[model samples]
Target chain A: MHAIQQQYWAVRDYLSPVLKESKFKEHGRITPEEFVAAGDFLTYKFPVWTWEKGDPSKARDYLPADKQYLVTRGVPCLRRATSLAYTDADEDAERLLSFGDGSAAGGEAEDWVETHAGRQSNADSAANPGSIDDIPDLDGDGAHEDEGLSSAVGNLSLSGAKVPDTPHLDDIPDMEEDLEDDDDAAAAPSKAAPSSNTVIDGSEIEVANGNLLQVRTYDVMITYDKYYQTPRTWLLGYDENRTPLIPAQIFQDVSADHAFKTVTIETFPHSGTLQAASVHPCKHASVMKKLIERMNAGVVEEQKAQRKSGSKDAKKKWMFRRASGNGKDDKPLPDDEDVEGMRVDFYLVVFLKFIASIVPTIEVDSTTAF
Target chain B: MPVVQFTQFSSLVQPTFWHELTRLKLEVLKLSDASVPLTAHYSAGRTIKDRNTGQEVALGCNFTVGSESFDEKHSLPPFAVVAKGIVKNYNTIDEFKNADKRALFSQAADEIWDSIEKDHDASALNRFLLITFADLKKYKYYYWFAFPALVAHPLWDIEDDWKEAKEQFTDKQLLSLHGHLEASTTPYFLVRPAVAGDGVDIAPVEDYTSFFANVPTDSQTIGFFDPSPHPSSPGWPLRNLLAYLRAVHPTTTSTLRVLCWRDTEPAHESGQWKSRFGVLTGGPAEGKPSAVGWEKNPQGKLGARAADLAPMMDPTRLADQAV
Candidate 1:
């Protein structure tokens, strides 16, 4: 709610191109205050809970120790790409000095302090070689955003931080239902109850496809949808010899959920897949919250059990063991709950990967329980 | 190992913008992670003397201000991603009909996949990306602030006048402070960046270093805090840099954006940060270095503040939990 009051730009230089696109039906410039006011993503229906694995080896470490009843191991989808390097600052002194030559007009010590820092500092410095940009008219009224946001807000309880169950969090809009009722959304599902994602191997009746008849395997990929501004999952399947899987092969897996849930998207929106079965993003916060909470509870329960059975000194020893690393409890711990990569049920992720795809003809399987 | 990370936070938080900030926190994190008790000074655009060339040059300027577009020249410096690969096994429900090793594996795998996807659908779709950004600008930004955190370390130690702490600095270091004092009305800290001896880069050492020059090989502990006059208006890039450095990555100790802006218009009023020796404590002079465990690499010291900021990392505990 930046409203009409704060220092806001009606013109969005950063988002103009994307917002002007037809994908987003509603368009307007967003202010920093309003952007921050949008609040946390946890409040969204299908909040994307990203699980970060630092190295590729990190993913291998996420395998469950006890695979007794394990099915397909969940595939961690690629989300972000990163790079970092630490340089010797002293060595960089030469490099830093050689950087773009900005004028540095020398000024009084009182006139050139640090808070005076900004993107314009260099430009302003370039204007006057040795003087500071303390002159009010030049940049004090310059086009920048609000005063410094003192609160970093990193503790806003979004990334699995302890967010108390508050009533306001429950007011999430029914994004899926609203879309289902809209006409001209070409991809909305026509089938009744039990969505494609839920009807897997269920009793739902199968629908007929024009000429496609074979079931196929495809990788489920989730990408953000510009139209709805939400995450949408798409199917990228393959056959033997690694040839791209046909629409039929991918659709075969969706017999029941297929008829009403998906739209055969011939053109891949942003990924490498040939054609995809697109659908609405699925709901995942609850299950993920359950998994996280259970992990914490398991640790506490194990500690409590140990305390009751062992001597106080042994208990003290156990605490030290966990802290210093390597103990019997540590032995039991790894086998119990080490799967920490971006986690999701392999099937559920595939199912919701395209919640917003296939146009608007089919709707998400809202009634089914995950 | 000290990598500042970022991913698309939310729709409100632009992806490309955040992607640019990914490597930012590393500078402060690594400095604090290093055993060099440090401080951050707002040194943007200040004329700094280059020892190598004997030429006085203006340091960094408010690269984050002037325009709304991403700092076209400086912000998104090219960075390489070192991602690890993962092998994915693909199969369908029909493959489970047979009893071969392949069929059995497919059946089991498909079952777990179905259960998790079906059960955890919502949360799975919501994403918090963890990606890395590596660049020299990140290193520069770190030094820009680290200089102050390094110098502020001395002031944090004593209750009496910090001039007592100033005595510890060498003439060269004091001269740098004089340079800072002469350059701006606001006070700033000055220090020499640490190099790993040889012409090449060195891995993390189990030791600490002094922030200044002409010090004894054994003295890796002091820097000069100059009371340079700071700027009045706040800018976008500097604020973003500070906030990014203080970002919270649960696995790592949290760093706070401790820099602040001061009003130079009302010149007569001296605030809490204003020291007696024409030095005022605002900007990078604010926050203390986060506490680090030193049970691994012991630095010879007495002050509680310095000891807590030691950068020793234990291989054992860190390795036990790879997340």
Candidate 2:
């Protein structure tokens, strides 16, 4: 049964249309060339990350020898996952995610993305507790409203027709309120997340009491997945003493929601014998597509707002704080009118934002101000 | 006074190190079992006290090496000591096991002794050797680590109880010392309070004779980047340094203050460094000293540790099991 499914997946993946355009709005997955382009863009924006060469024996023929993978080393992780109180609500959202293998039977990519959107709302609510009542009800079959676009083969642009149906995507007022709350939360780190458990091992306390000055640091590397056809991120963690953390210990650094399910210990393709905790790339495309759609919806909302307010300069603030690549200036982009979607180069920056949600404590993503 | 016995170093060979070694084997070495130069690191691990004895337990120091060890330009952490080591990769397990273990160990020890005695390279005091056989086909690796220390005829005796670093120097002085030591490249060095005032002055171990020329013999302090967490005894790297010291200053019988410099966190000015100070009195014989050092397996027996990385390394098995 598994072999048959594997054969089917292989066949479908083989037949999946190669993305010719740079934008990955339709499917999160990108061609190898697109992955290289995105990597170059990420490296250009964040000098901390650089393209590194892999072992010659394991080098893929398709990728350049010097640019086989992207690496950012010694990214500090202040605390453990246990330190972050896990709310039952977060677990419910985690269960809603479809992070299974990339089999065609795992349902439509749009449906998977819709569920992901629902989970992100829950995550958003978890971050901003005051907006609990304002969250639009996502119960029943009304959740997967847009069903026509789901497919493994095609480049049907997500923003071609109407805006995505996610309520929070269009709700500018609530998003602004959430941003205000986020800035407040950033100022006062105590009330940052709506955590339930009283097990708060603050970084200062850990350093003061336990003499744990050397916080665990991780090396984050992104490699292109051949089968999943999306970029897969791998983490290699070092403990306070700088000893490599085993897979089990590495899981402690990951958010409880995606610990063992979404993350797996596997041999790094570039470095043959080395194994690391990799964020599974199965649902990457779906998640990326949903994020891109939400980004477009955000722009459309801004465009509407700009039209209503009659502001001379358009503010293209990237939806996310960390993923605000080249959007930090808050200036109107030259291609603001083209608002077709985020350029494909921003795929990795957005992907990193998604990863930051999973590993909230890792500081690598913040190296680039954008 | 009790005889001070140093704790041996435990090897923490990271998987990335093995992966890099495998890469070098396949791409660079290619069936040629040659010695590869490697620089490892060791720091003072956490100090744990025995609940029953109420005494600080001597934990084996850890000497670690990883992917960065292959990068010659990689800068080490401030608290870490550059432990010079060599990797002898064997093509097969039989060759690794059946090889003359004693001969290889003695040869490594002899080279270190020559560096210490003839070349007078103080940095050679932190020499170690590793032998590995990476069975790439099976995704298994058999390895052993050795940290050679020349045996002292009369093992040094601790003349006094260990005192915290804060006991001897103020926080300001320690901060200055920490700052100075952060830039030190060699593991063994001489540290003393500045002649004029507030901070401390540090000089390489090779400048020992000149460093102590003006200072009172009673106040001279010798320090090394100690890797052990033992509250009473220093780590293994100190033994060779002590041996070299005694050989150089044979006629002088004045007590030498030894600093087990264990900076738990050198990056932060927590002033919570776990360093200790104790005085030692004794020395080894003048002639060529015999060396002994071979790390035991986890079970406390002399054997190589084997790691089966197939579950994590095999791509086919991983893919088949993934869905």
Candidate 3:
């Protein structure tokens, strides 16, 4: 397996249970096949790869006519190379030997020699032509070509093809240049073009992240005019079996651009005058009426008592006396009076009495309403 | 009938003596019957001239008159009536006997005798009659004095009571009244009772008397007369009526004035009437004439006017003067 693929498996295995508890089930199931599929899908949708140079392979020259088609298709190209070192001559010689019909005698002879000598051979067989195996045929139909093919197959088995440390984009020179250029551009404007050969634009990725997925996500760029802006993306992950898990990195992204617009609700204002309108007007009027009525009744009773005496003159005289007595011992009279010795005339008194009767009621109504 | 006699003669005498005599007559009447006869005689006398100035002058002589009456079968001698006078210049008794001389002597004697008779008659009248007359006069005078006092006293009393009542009224009644008027009823004009210490404008003494006196015959001023002899005796019932009126029509100005009077202090001594009437003290801006001697009461203002009449009159001073 590729090292990257191996690392991915190891991390997934370690984080799977944690991810499940954290509710990121979909991410937990991202196997190599799924990863590759996702990458291919991305590539197809936004292709960034292009031919970088003409095909360069030595295997094509020696291919037979029928096999020549493979070379033309660039299937025989050596996409990766890896270094290997030799430790002992026998292993080296074995690696350098060509595959043939049976080599038991040679293997025995080599073993006998090594046993008699009591030491291992120090020969550099990888560089020696003598280490090459002679061709042998199994059917003995006098088919030399088959003998050579078997020998070639044996050689191929002896040496393994090396894998490259970095994946190369053979068909996409523009993408390579874009990737190189993005390092510098990324520092200045995160929202700038990813690269000339970028498979996906930032806006497309944002739309996908926000709408297409079950757990919506988005990259928000909070801007101060156009000069100052913060770029951030939040990945809201969800799974069929679990709640979504937002990665810490995405949380950091959201927080960095926290000054974004958000939705809110609206409200009103409270005041006394506004509230007063709802009160019952009659309540105040009723209170006023009661007060005035009581007062009027009291006044009437007093007047009746006065009238019954039939001595308004004498009473007035006494009142005068008492009043002149420095108000020392006299009791107070009721609010109203008869016409006999009153300072005002009868008509005025009547008018005033009527007014007094009504005044309290009105005042009461006003206050109550207020 | 027993006759009481009096002798009269022409001479200069003190008016005080006449007054004393009149008093004596009245005292006598208090103790005696009216039909009792009293007699009086006047005697004529000769006057003597100064010897150094011997211009012939009539000689002076004192004479006496005597009255006689039989007490049984025996005759009683008459008592002489005597008098002294300045002699005239006539040379003879014949000259003194002329018409002018006789007329002068008779007239002097008659004048003295008539005065004596009148005094005796006055002394014989009924005691009750005299007492009643004196009392009536005193009462009349007091009526004048008490008019302001009566008016002021009750007014002061009512004023004070109303003051306290007013506070209560404002606290309890007025507020309610205001509320009622504002709410259920149309507000009537406000009527405030006169406050104690709010100066009243009493009429000046002259103006007060004149105002009543000058009132046209057809005017109601004459209506003030009380046909009932003792008007003040039935004071309480009248007061009750006034009080009732006050309550029923608290906004009545007339009733308020009456109440103000009922609540005020009485005027006792002289000058105190001014203070009591609030005329000397002044009163609210009601534009009414003062009840006492009007001098534009300095304390005049709104509401009732209270004056320390006790201080103005100073009963102690009157008492001292009486002593």
TM-score of each: 0.18, 0.57, 0.10
lDDT of 2 by residue, B16-40 (tens): 7877888889999999988888888
If the candidates were sorted by their TM-score against the true structure, best first, what order would they fall in? 2, 1, 3
iRMSD for each candidate structure, in the order shown: 32.4, 23.8, 77.1
- Model 1 chain A lDDT-worst window of ten: A76-85
Q: Per-prediction DockQ, in order?
A: 0.01, 0.06, 0.00
For model 3, residues A156-257, the per-residue Cα lDDT tens digits are 321222212111212111111111111211011212232332222112222332321111112111000100011101112111111111121111111111
**Among all candidates shown, the one with the greatest DockQ:** 2
**Candidate 1: deviation at residue A168, Å?**
56
* Stretches of model 1 off by over 4 angstroms after superposition: A1-217, A220-233, A255-259, A262-269, A272-274, A286-370, B1-323
Backbone collision tally, model 1: 102
Best by the TM-score measure: 2
Give per-residue CA lDDT, model 2, range A20-118, as digits (tens). Answer: 554467777787787888898888666557887767777866678778899876566655553454555555544343544433222333324221112
State each model's CA lDDT, in order.
0.23, 0.64, 0.20
Task: Give the local distance difference test score of model 3.
Answer: 0.20
Q: Comparing chain B with the reference, what is the TM-score for each candidate?
A: 0.20, 0.90, 0.15
Which sequence of candidate numbers ranks them by DockQ, best first?
Answer: 2, 1, 3
After superposing candidate 3, which stretches have Cα over 4 Å from the reference? A1-370, B1-197, B204-323
